[model samples]
Target: MTHNTDLPDVVPIFPLPGALLLPRARLPLHLFEPRYLAMLDDALKTPQRLIGMIQPNKVPGRSGSGLHTIGCVGRVTQFSETEGGRYMITLAGVSRFRLIEEVEGFTPYRRARVSWAGFERDQGPEEGDTAFDRGAFLQTLSQYFDSQDLQTDWDSLKEADDELLINSLSMLLGFEPEDKQALLEAPCLSTRRETLMTLIEFAMRGGDGEGMLQ
Candidate 1:
């Protein structure tokens, strides 16, 4: 496990909208673009093998250079190369970071200097959600999944711990980019769970009062 101090002050960033990586979560990426491939190559050479996963802000009039201030950093825990010259890698989330500024560089991909302050909890043990209502949450999730025509391993989800279940859902769900960013920026497990439930309920309602809950 990498501590906050062990993380670098600057890291190559991957600005992917609608992609949320939470602490202790794993995000698998398929990198084919030449710039990202180069970024991966450079990252693999470093000791930490870290990459900042940030989202490009889509707010009106700020789409060009605006990015959400917060992002999660992950370590390259698994890697493989495909015959098509693409790279498949699994990044194990280390901690969430605050983007300080974009570093001026000649690299093909973007890089940023980040601060890990106020996020020390990200490197600690898994958080417990005492307020979590698994049965009710699952009921709502089941309805949401059914509405979206999504399928998953129910048994696996049932066995997962509270943090895993909520964070996984927060990351993997097809929510809007801003909603996903909200989940990522949640201060704690319980807060994230609450945000996730609200998002699910809103989705079930079709974002308005039109659709009936399944």
Candidate 2:
């Protein structure tokens, strides 16, 4: 378990669009790019084995390739080297950090100094959503999945608790990058659940929805 004092001030960042990692959630990544492979190598040497997962802001004319202000820091909990020099790793999210500044360095990947001031709760235990409407949410999800031609284990989703169901959907859904960011930046579990519900409802009503398990 990671505590507030255990986190580092600066860490390596991987800017991937549409990839969201919330606290207590897991993100699996495939690293074949040379720069990211190097980044993984360096991260493994650190005591925390932490890496920042952020999305590249797609808005035009923004600097530093337009990184979002907030990103989640995750520890490399699972790692395996594959054939063709590729790496597969699963990151267990620790906390959300505000990007203070991008550090200039010779390393192939980007690093940032982050502030964890507002997200101390992320280092604590899983949160419960008192206002979650699981029945309605699942109904909407079923409709959306039908529209997208997607499939999933409904039994497992029904069995998952509020945090796991909401967070997992927020991570796995095919919403836009900005929508995913909104979910990530949400202040709490209930807000994220609301945002997720809205996104799904919007997608069902002719929004640009794509990507799902078929």
Candidate 3:
């Protein structure tokens, strides 16, 4: 799709820990806070309705938390204004970027000049990037789900491609913030798959199956 520009030079940043949005993946967000609500309002008027999802330097409750340098940029694909004057929207991941610096903006939310130079592959079409190890993922999934008393469609799992499988699970699961960040910052899809397997295995072993993504 041709855009106003080939790439967005700057984007509004959303610092929500544990929210992982990979390229082509979708993330739904609720905007109630004044800062983020305002950010959404401004983004709607821009050429590219893009928002950068990143983790905080420190978890919100912890001290010294600012924002992470690496994040995935997403475009607003779905939106709705709630009766309570809130916004419910979904973002479709566009590409990953590295934050250079935060720029002062009128919006209450923070803005950053980010670089997408190294992630050229993310913008273009996805190839059969990597061979998905369905058996391994299912084996671990079975154990975790069974232990958690969760039921899912085996057929759907079988049909989902590697990217969808990994990103879907990553977003759906209640992994810890750090673990989620690790999966998001994974160098490639293959690496994310491997990290996912490791996480699942850990969750499976942790008693009662509510693996707290250590």
Candidate with the greatest TM-score versus the true structure: 2
lDDT of 1 by residue, 79-197 (tens): 99998999999999999999988899899999998999999999999999998999999999999999989999999999999999999999998888888888999999999999889
Clashing residue pairs found in predicted model 2: none
**Candidate 3, superposed: residue stretches over 4 Å from native:** 2-5, 59-65, 127-129, 207-214
Relative to the true structure, candidate 2 reaches a TM of 0.95
TM-score each candidate. 0.94, 0.95, 0.88
Q: What does candidate 3 score on TM?
A: 0.88
Q: Which has the higher TM-score value, candidate number 1 or candidate number 2?
A: 2
lDDT per residue as tens, model 2, 1-214 = 9988888899899999999999999999999999999999999998899999998876666545489889999999999999999999999999999998999999999999999999999988889998877898899899999999999999999999999999999999878888898899999999989888888888888966442210
Candidate 2 ranges with C-alpha deviation above 4 Å: 61-65, 209-214
Ranking by TM-score: 2, 1, 3
Q: lDDT for each of the candidates?
A: 0.91, 0.90, 0.81
Model 3 lDDT tens row, 60-136: 54323377778998999999999889989999988888888888867789988888877876776753545776887
Show the colliding residue pairs in model 1: none
